[model samples]
Target chain A: MNSITTPSYAVHFNQIAYTELNKHLSQSKYSKIFILVDENTHNYCLPTFLAQINEDYDFEIIEIEEGEVNKNIHTCTQVWEVLSELDADRKSAMINLGGGVVTDLGGFVASCFKRGIDFINVPTTLLSMVDASVGGKTGVDLGPLKNQIGVINQPQMVLIVPEFLKTLNERQLQSGFAEMLKHGLIRDAAYWESLKAVLDFENIADFIYTSVTIKNEVVLQDPTEQNLRKILNYGHTLGHAIESYFLESPKHDLLLHGEAISIGMILEGYLSFKLTGLPESELNDIKASFLARYKKTTFTKTDIDTILTLLKFDKKNSHGNVNFVLLKNIGECAIDIKVPEDLLKEAFEFYAE
Target chain B: MNSITTPSYAVHFNQIAYTELNKHLSQSKYSKIFILVDENTHNYCLPTFLAQINEDYDFEIIEIEEGEVNKNIHTCTQVWEVLSELDADRKSAMINLGGGVVTDLGGFVASCFKRGIDFINVPTTLLSMVDASVGGKTGVDLGPLKNQIGVINQPQMVLIVPEFLKTLNERQLQSGFAEMLKHGLIRDAAYWESLKAVLDFENIADFIYTSVTIKNEVVLQDPTEQNLRKILNYGHTLGHAIESYFLESPKHDLLLHGEAISIGMILEGYLSFKLTGLPESELNDIKASFLARYKKTTFTKTDIDTILTLLKFDKKNSHGNVNFVLLKNIGECAIDIKVPEDLLKEAFEFYAE
Candidate 1:
């Protein structure tokens, strides 16, 4: 498959393409290489990574504790201290060798270290391969607010090798699938319908690649989220709020990003039907398809009110108004749509139905 | 004077220019405004700033504890939390209202806030107005390391109002003067000679403005420090090491940035004479002028060894080689020159003499 390009970087998708990574490394001639990983990937993925790279390169491994909770400045400080202690310099290149938490934190760390060093994302999870790959958005969550602190900086390259997906649990796989579904719902109705047929994990690389291309095309036209790129946030605004809400409430289980976003897409589908005239039948189809895959998540009345309040804190919002990305039709979206409170309530009711 | 433009953002220099700031505030139409300050600026600069603005603005003040030691991830978290709690949105503009520490941390915070928001710098110190005004460098020190964690991000505008300098102590004024002297040595010989004639604070705005222009021109040519931009680091290489050294060592008082760099320029001048064949007379002249202004700093043999070791940690370095930017002569310098250990020792001896 051909490589996808963002304004500042490229995304290369190959199945087990260690040679491609090696070739790029030789050409760049980095002073040293450092791989950032979480405990899980360090244990499961490092052996394969070491075996595949057929070059004598000076490299070291920096590991952080696993999971999204560890994705904060505390971990960043630890990693930075390690890099300093190990004497990493401006010419050093960091290979982010894990899932979204690893890549996101590593990308941010590298971008700020010496005003940025070269970083290549070797995404180990499906969510990162498609979602995090194209968007040059690198950041960490602040106090349960997802991605509140970060910079829009592109990595040197993104190397996607599908074999790493073999280790992901079922929940992780499904979480990644939600983003692929988002790509389809926002840009390609045909892609969305085809994705509905995907029940198993067999032959998912092509789908992931397609989702990345869709996102890349959108980002190329609007890198700064001024207009077209906002379409990519169709499910994200509400989804992110819901994700944060659950993460903060001890009573609720933490919603994997994809799971919360799955709910968000359904609610926004209903909003699209009411506000943007997205066909009612298509809205039902969208909800039904998502509900079929992601187990239904129930939000209490108070939870609904809290989520609504959280919407004001959404980065997309301005002047205390929540601006949403709503679909005009499947595969077509509108940016900066102001949904009324009654309509938002109705949309949630529709999701419950 | 007219605004100076870099590839990204503008620097506006005016004396008590509330009208210009009001005009910019109205034109920007930010959802709200927030001013970031330290205790000193809040006490001294804020009232003057409030009295000057002609237009009404819906703004609030957020104050952090003063000093370079406070520039850390902890402060960033606090500010981010405050911004979140206060409901500062993506469209809100942040005014960094103080010296280098405030501008540096505020710039980084704003840049990372929601992937970035617009920020305007109101530099209250001479060090910031001339030096920090141009370069998009924003960061805080990591564990006594200067600017160890930061991103190269420009503010929406840099508003340089010279009246703020009135409140600065003599030491603060001298510290800032060191950078101005550097501006002359690295690029403009005539400017250097003109600055030497300056013994009073009256009519220093032109000198500050000239230094800003020289730095801006260099930055416009090379924002990434790929080659030409490294010229700006002429004194910064050894200077940073020395700054970090004193900041960490219990035996020595902390050296202000400009004081450390003053020493660095003399040492590098001596190295230039040895390695780059800079004229002996010119080197002596450089040393004499710096010594006349900055109090002499003495380093023991152990201090020299430690500073040399710290050089490897300099962000400008690559592959364990300490690259020095040496002067070919006044107003001219060379980048990436590797000085041998013996010469580095000799340069220190020359400084000690």
Candidate 2:
């Protein structure tokens, strides 16, 4: 049983699992409850969620198509209209019960519905539980761009349940592991070492808890992303560009956010070795760990050029400069480091290897 | 030269005028500049604005179609794509240079672009200068619903130039006057009487300044609209429903926001007289002032039923209750006041007179 509070909201672990959720709901006395889920979560997670909560409060289930492509303004409009049609008032609470797609879109829809409404995240995927659901960054993509339209609005609460992770496939689980690895790389060496030592799902709950705590701590310190919060975006700059690139390319398979970021970490690690003087041994360790888990992705000369161009659109960029967060050491990262084009090409070469 | 700062941003009247805007722009040193204008403003107001700002900065003009219909997600997508195609970075600054449609959509686009960016509102309409530009509420309409999907993010600055009002037609001018009169009715009896006494466009600048000040004061007190801010929505609850109803109905002409709210104020005045014991004479005075300026609108029995049904969708509602902000007196309002259906019908009858 553990609880952590950010400036805007709170995250509760096993202590306030199901019974606590019912109690919180009863005490809050919301007018009605609406649960937002994509097809996958509606099929897999909703039944388990229903079984846990004993309260007979009035609630409705809203299902959207699952996947990254569905995370757009059209979907948002549909959800908003549905909420309005259902007569969801300001006092009504929404529970987002799915992965990143559901939580991100639902959080945004809730935030803008009638200016805003109370929403809680009950993440049903490893990727979302460890990463997306913890932070207040909720939004959908604009065209092929990633999170181009959104606001930094926190949810009322985030409930993390490990039982929901039973539904994730191996790739989905690995996708989430990338962020956990990121938490260790950016802040804690021992945590990184511990995560690397155990790649199995035996203590997945412990891993999620630690990841959540690390992300929550960083976000709490810098909710507005003035300085410290940018550190949380260590792999995100290049990672996001790559994610958007592949998501838009008709020929390439869509890369899960974590998968793209994993490649970004490897490329950034190489850049770190070249520019930031990160030890070659640590860089090798990083490369080996990522390559072993994530399938190697190849980019052509044209693809590289496109990715470079896309980097300018990264929200982190200011004054058209593509800033990178490179690892100074395995556990320490430096921000706003500008890397040379030649070194970026070499980093891509290293990732391809 | 008067400047008032809200918790979110600042409103500069005459002091931080065009010259100050030029200096502010130079000091900020943004990556790029963009001006969002509707066709009307582009044709009429852009020349005046360009002439005042002597400094030449790298800027582009992005124009959308004029009127309320264009304030939708599709328009937002087009503007976002244009910004993307033009490579507008996080440091880019957007100047919303039109009436409420341009400012509302542009503010929302800028807020969500790259998570958020710096934007300044240069309101070109009386309604916008006094009301829309002051509050941080920015969004496009969802279907016939007004401001259904939006956020409460303020601009970096609001620059109000009354010179833009010279281009407005009499109906448009009167539309804005409705809100000014509302400012007086809800908060300042003296202000209300002053507005009633002078219905002509002469001394319109003083009226605009006073209305902006009053609205800013109320918004500053409650940015989140939890308590004090709800008072500002006094006429909006029913007014919004009526506006949305007419906008959707093929039989009726689109009512200007101020026009719809004027009728709402009269209806609410009747409710206030019945439920809150607002003086019969004051209610009569309120009705007379509104009818003198705005042409009386007639609502059939079906229209009233439809408008009443639409009340449930008002953003102000909670727990299915059509909560309203009713006038307790000419100078004060009580929020979250629920009026019975019978009383609502009577209020409509009072408006018909």
Chain B, candidate 1: TM-score: 0.97
Q: Which stretches of candidate 2 lie over 4 Å from their true place?
A: none
lDDT of 2 by residue, B64-165 (tens): 999988899899989999998888888899999999899999998998887788999999888998988677999888887789878888898888888888
Residue A10, candidate 2: alpha-carbon lDDT: 73
Please, what is the whole-model Cα lDDT of each candidate in the order they appear?
Answer: 0.89, 0.87
User: What RMSD does model 1 have?
Assistant: 1.6
**lDDT tens string, model 2, A1-353?**
57777877777776476766888798999998999998889889899888888878888999999999999988998998898888888899999999999999899889888778889898888888888866688989887788887877888888888888788888889998999999999999999999998767756888888888999888878778887778888788889989999999999999999999998999899889988889999999999998888999989999999998888887778887888888899888888898778888888888887
Q: After superposition, how far is residue A58 of candidate 2 from its true place, in Å?
A: 1.0
- iRMSD, all candidates: 0.9, 1.3
- Specify the poorest-scoring 10-residue window by lDDT in model 1 chain A: A11-20
Error of 1 at A295 (Å): 1.2
Q: Every model's DockQ, to 2 decimals?
A: 0.84, 0.77
lDDT string, candidate 1, B231-292, tens digits: 88988888999998998899899888889999999999999999888899989988999898
Quality of model 2 by C-alpha lDDT: 0.87
